[model samples]
Target: MSEPTGVLTLRLAGPLQSWGAASRFARRATERAPTKSGVLGLLAAAQGRDRSADLSDLAALRFAVRLDQPGTRVRDFQTAHHADTGKSMPVSERFYLSDAVFVAAVEGDRDLIGILHAAVRSPVYLPFLGRRSCPPSRPVDLRAHPSGLWKALEAEPWQASTWVQRSRARERRVELEVIADLSAGDGPGDAVRDQPLSFDPRHRRYGLRSVHSRAVTVANPLSAPRRAFVPTQHDPMGLLED
Candidate 1:
């Protein structure tokens, strides 16, 4: 496989994030992590690109997601009446990841990735997690890296919440899970139909994409015992100990 020239990292941290690839009417489901189609859509939205825009260029890029902090799955209920029927509609069962944090990376040419990175930082259209109702809690743009999407995902630090990070700090080693686009020679994984052919709502289309799961270990950045600072005046024994 060819090495990636550039990479764009996105911090997908939100109170309630939904990235459903196979969602149908009245039932919306979410994937464990962000989808490639969803991330591309986000980039396009940031660039103010319309749905009819040709995404072939964007879709060609490799995508990967790091499970920084797997949040709890919550089922939400909502009711919406038909537009023309004007009658009660079935309550939509929307699934979301509450307090989830993921690090998604895209590897591609510098020109394209650079444009996307800029758009992420300064999106023309407001960015949302998946649906418009589920906006990200913080900025999605993490930063840029020089490695490919897979390597970047492996190398990036844990993006979990402060509490989660602190809790993990007690551990001697931290292992993170990552799902990335599988190459020709890579190991096999479950097939998923998420590659977006087009974003046209009228006739949306998708293609099958293969992904493989793997784990990488990183030294805990915060694996240090917590300490409370004591003022010399408050602790006369501190001077004696010194």
Candidate 2:
């Protein structure tokens, strides 16, 4: 079986990130990690591909993402009054993740991957999370991986923030989950409702796609720190006195 020789790796970390799967009116939700559509849309923005442009080619690339850190979910209430109607609008709950991080990989033709990587480095149009309101906090481009999506995602180091990394590094090892696009013979995975049909705002559409998930335990991806935290299960010394 032939596969793309290169995969584009990206660090999707930011103060606030949101990837909506099934958001309804007055209630905006988000996925734990970046979605295929969201990532691909970022690429398109890098290449300056308009919303009406052809996405079939970009969508063909194999997609995968590893959850380095599942940020905390926060909700904000939004209130507005209708333009025509003189009634106050319902309070909308907008959700966002704070200090989230993810390593997203796209496997495709080497040349294509290279181009996408460059686009990310210097995007033609600004790249946002899932919505324009949630802009990325840091650079999105990591580098190009000359391997399969799974290998790249697994090999890449944890992308959590420094403080978060230190907190987890005290444990010395962390288990991360990987979700990748699949057809058959790739083991069992959940079908996600993120496959993009059309990104048209007027007629947005979505479909289901298969994704396999697996846990990978790796040594603390962060390097040596000044101090390591030791969280013991039992209070050997009984430091807390009644």
Candidate 3:
């Protein structure tokens, strides 16, 4: 008999988040959606794993994320000086998504999922959105789901901010995007170089993985009733007085 599997979901929301898969040198870039390697790194951090710790087990978990609120992409410049030499360092350009909210899920063994669920609530190290400076706005752990990745994502309610939810409620139904890993024997989806191999700072490495994207529609909980329109009298002549 084989062990049953479960899904663990996380809410990644903050004022600022930066998930860079290809950042290098003095420039730091971020992907529109959260990366698999980045989410696993967060899990490793929750378990108090070191940078050089073994990640073979964590790498095997299937990953997926839903963009509850695809926030705006913004850039900023940073200036600093080297401490040891007292010399000014090159200005760095960094990009981040402001006011973003995402739902990340990983399907794996039930025991491991349970362990991770506990670790997140009382993480050894506090969880951050994507960078050390950008911490999460809410609790990351959404608990474990009995269903797999897709169902779990679909079942999870919209996690956008109240303002965003109200703005979106104009539509009766809203569609949210989902990006998920392709399993074996699946069709060739888009390939991305964000899979984690090792997190060793000296020699960090990543492999290629295929991901497929789709959208799921959910009824707007804040959908407001349509208001009847009434014409105001003499509004056209009011501009002449100004």
Candidate 4:
């Protein structure tokens, strides 16, 4: 008998975020969206799990993210010196998403999902969007959704900021992109290497996971308002008295 399952949704919004699955050397790069490993790591941190802790159970949960407000990508450079040697290290370039918002969801056994929900509300360790430097602007927990992953994402109201929503007020509906784990019997998807194998720093590892992408349109809450009619002032000349 299979265990009953549920989905937990997280609101990942921040002033700056960096989710880099393939970052290396002095050039740390962030993916356009959050990675599965990054989101799972967040839950693990909420539970106060150590880096070396087994992640099989958490890794088994299916993952997905909705790009609510795709923020601007910006870069900065930093130079640091070795503490022990007092020698300057190489200049490093780091990238971040400014003012990005994402709705990340994971589906798993109901019992496990419940525990994660509780952990998120009062996490053992404070949760960050993707890195420690990028703290969430709002509470991360949006509660558990009874529906499935894709449906939950579609049903969730627009999470964009007031200004962002207002910026697109002219539109009646907005299309948001969703990226989710590919399941059996589904069409082919692009492969990514962000699946968590181990968070162990000594020997960190990852596996390939297939992900599918789609878009959902939701009503714009801040749709454009009707323009009020204004009586035109009579021209002083009155068109030269016609």
Which stretches of candidate 2 lie above 4 Å from their native place?
A: 1-4, 83-87, 221-242
lDDT of 3 by residue, 7-91 (tens): 9999999999999999999999999999999999999999999999999889999999999999999999999998999899999
Q: TM-score of predicted model 2?
A: 0.85
Tens digits of lDDT, candidate 2, 119-145? 988889988988888888888888898
Judge candidate 4 at residue 159 and give its lDDT. Answer: 91
Regions more than 4 Å wrong, model 1: 1-4, 83-85, 225-242
lDDT of each: 0.86, 0.84, 0.92, 0.93
Model 2 global lDDT (CA atoms, 0 to 1): 0.84
The whole-model C-alpha lDDT of candidate 4 against the native structure comes to 0.93
Please, what's the RMSD in Å of model 1?
5.9
Model 4 C-alpha lDDT per residue in residues 38-128, reported as the tens digit of each score: 9999999999999999999999999999999999999989899999999999999999999999999999999999999999999999999
Output the lDDT of residue 237, model 3.
72
Q: How does residue 143 of candidate 3 score in lDDT?
A: 78
Candidates in order: C-alpha RMSD to true structure: 5.9, 6.4, 5.3, 2.9
Sort order, lDDT high to low: 4, 3, 1, 2
* lDDT-better candidate, 3 vs 4: 4
Pairs that collide in candidate 4 are none
TM-score of each: 0.88, 0.85, 0.90, 0.91
Q: Across residues 1-242, which tens digit of lDDT does each residue of candidate 1 receive?
A: 75448999999888888999999998999998889999899999999999998999899988888888889999999988879989998888999989999888888887888899999888999899988988988888888887666667767777788788778777756888888889888876878999999899899999999999888776666777767986665765777783
